[model samples]
Target: MTTETGFTNVDHEFFHRELDAFLPDRIYDAHAHMWKRDWASFTLGADIQNVGIAEYDRAIAEIHGDRPTETLFLSFATPDHLDLIDEANAWTADQIKGRPACRGHFFITPQQDPEWVRDEVKRLGLHGLKCYHTFADCSPTWEASIPDYLPEPFVAVANDEGWTITLHMVKSRAIADPDNLHWIQKYCRSYPDMQLILAHSARGFQPAHNLEGLGKLAGIDNLWFDTSANCEPIAHQAILRLIGPDRLMYGSDLPVSHARGRSLGASDSFIWLYEETPVWGEKHIRIEPVMVGLEHLRSVKWACWSERLTDQQVEDLFWNNAARLFRLDT
Candidate 1:
């Protein structure tokens, strides 16, 4: 049976059978989000409305059990709700108060003054910045270029402050696009102190793109990747093999992680299969999908197995890597 929060018997079984043994004793969630419902332009369900640090802890416990878990909380707000960015970021900062092991990122838009953003991040005591393509001034944001949304002025502030920027890049070809590679290399090379984290396995939902592009991104020490809700094994496997596990950290992608579905790599693209997707059954057989978080963990397990990573290396993927990046005492 599934709970109101979306955890189900299927997820429990999947976790115990496939993930319990593979997970480390401590987990550092490098990516997750928190916000108030009123701050969003879109309607949020009562279950997810007003999600704060406490609520996040409760939701994650369904998957993490009693194991100690810390998070790098991201501020959440859609493009239409730009007016609420300050409140949303304030909420995130408040949620992480007193939780030294945890950190938060200020949500940024391209139009904001760079000086204001830098001062705001310091005022909120946030560690980094989070930028999305939806805020870009483009017709179809999915295909927007890096600088279209994440302006250089903001990146310069991050570089000066030595802050991390969690970037969710967009394009039809993901990282394989020449423009994407050029911009990524430019920021990391020019801003040696600022760190750039590519979310969703470098947006490698389509593993073929990662396989084709990750090798080209080699030798950049400041570039990192987070395995956040990307269910394809090859996506994570390629990063581990080509980039090394030390530069890869774990990210739950929270609310999405609780969703019941998985992302499948299609021909040069990817598709998300939800619980209501009609392809789950055929003839007399039925397929029951677990939570995306569980599927994500399973994918990590498969990738580690394929890469023959040691237990310590696996721990680094789950915890140590992020700890070292955030300068958290272990």
Candidate 2:
């Protein structure tokens, strides 16, 4: 699968030898991002300037081998370029157009007019919205206050439109923070029309935090969890057990998930790179790393398989569940 960027599927022989037999025929990646470098604000280094649909296609081909797949492009939210939201959404929607298997979600902020959002959703036929809490509307302190987590105006627009929100939970313990969990519960209950897909299994950076949060919120009908760039198998297994197969979906968080640098062998290469930078006038620091793995999508499959999920359960995780959520069948 070659594209304009001279992007071709790379050799992922290691992934094949490990999990080929265990994987399904195809996958529906519920979470991914795609855009030209100039159109976006974030950077992963000069060598990795762009990650358009071509790059994504090549990478997924390498990861899945010969298996076919579908992906939903979630508009990336950057802290510095809040103004890029419309442009980012337009870029994604344009790139994935005419490809039924591919769809895109736009990014939104409460700062924007809700009526404009309603019109844009109808005009673009967008699948959903990718909400970056810390960047869009929240102050990223050690502990977030629930009363002011997300903008109520944007929440109302999404609910009125009956749109899905792909939320990356913020705060100290990711999703486990008491205030964060309470905010999620409030949103889910208050906005019955809105569907919420918690990214990274509610940011299971620590498996224990993930389990704790999942235990508290698993029964919510409108809530779903995506296994996107989550590296821990223990947390993934816990997600399956607590949230059940119907509420779990496949997500790669690609390009970000694409393994980079020299081979540190199979096992070692699976580990992603992390850079720690001082922040808050050196009072605190951010160690945000692009979650990478040679087999991120496969890792999710491996987790499901290890838990002895039936073929039907695997089907739901990789395809049907996302299909139902995003109305992909239509």
Candidate 3:
């Protein structure tokens, strides 16, 4: 792989040192996933599984090396975990051991019998709900993953129950079509009181060409996006400017692109958000690694975030906002 596009290899000295030295008492990483099973298949084309409990422990040791108070886990299972919603939540609950940072969004769909799994949802201490376009061979719109099913009262229940909803919102076929807007339109209209967090900054850093669809959804007040992998200039900057910081949250999509056997990569994209591109604008823009540090909260963004924002703002993003939104330990 070209050094320009391959995974970065930096001591990230400043970030590590700063995070280790200036530990926050209430910080919480909102977008990382936690699973204890072998997640090799999720690695896709990667050379290795890239994540596992051991590696996660090491990663937790490395980033949280300072050991922040808590972290809100975006619990998930492999594609294999989709169909068995009740089982998926049960597995993740065991993984969490019933803690906030160890928490997660239970997968939900209306297609099958649902199994609803209310008992498991309660037992698992589910923090929120997660829905993906790829699950059950489906799309976020009214389309069916099963070719005979649809997302319905299931979605309404999640909204009514006041569970945070995170949707994997950017892609090619599933996202770039008319069906893509259906859910947002339906959810925003149906559950006017719902809190919907869009995964990736309304679709990661879309160039000018792909901005319209994201922009349309921005009209919905219930719609929010996670900075998990939106560190790159395209969606990162645009979302900040267009969607505003209030609508954004930090996310690493951890281990997916990194080559771990359990967790996902720090991000699927944004490989160039900090390294090669000093600034992420048409020509010139402020390129603050600190902002990146604050956003990712684990890797190099720490040093940059410390330098860019006041100590309080850093704490706000790392802890306050997440605590208030997820109702986590403050």
- lDDT on C-alpha atoms for all candidate structures: 0.89, 0.69, 0.51
Residue pairs in candidate 2 whose N, alpha carbon or C atoms collide under 3 angstroms: none
Count of clashing pairs, candidate 3 = 27
Residue-wise lDDT of candidate 3 within 1-330, one digit each (tens)?
A: 212112222323534655556656655655666554353244322333444333444454434545544554565555555555556556666666735455577766544443454445666677567765555554553344322222555556666666677777544433344666666677767886567776655554433423445556656677766656443444444554555555556555654323311111232322344334434445566432332333444432433253354666556655666666776553
TM-score for each candidate, following the candidate numbering: 0.97, 0.82, 0.66
lDDT of 1 by residue, 122-151 (tens): 998999999989989997999999999999
Give the distance in Å from residue 34's predicted Cα in candidate 1 to where it truly belongs: 0.8
Q: Sort by TM-score, best first.
A: 1, 2, 3
Expressed as tens digits, the lDDT of each residue in 1-330 for candidate 2 is 533322324434455566677667888888888866765644433455777676677667655667888898998756566667678888788878877878777877646676887789778878777766554444453244533435666677789988888877766576668878888899899998989888876777566777667788878989998888776775677788887879988887765565342111122112233333222133466332222544455567667878899999988888899889888667
* lDDT, model 2, position 21: 77
Query: Residue 9 in model 2: shift from native, Å?
Result: 12
In candidate 3, stretches whose alpha carbon ends up further than 4 angstroms from where it belongs are: 1-9, 12-26, 38-57, 64-69, 79-87, 137-150, 173-178, 205-211, 260-314
Regions of model 1 farther than 4 Å from truth: 41-48
RMSD of 2: 6.9
Per-residue lDDT, model 1, residue 319, is 93
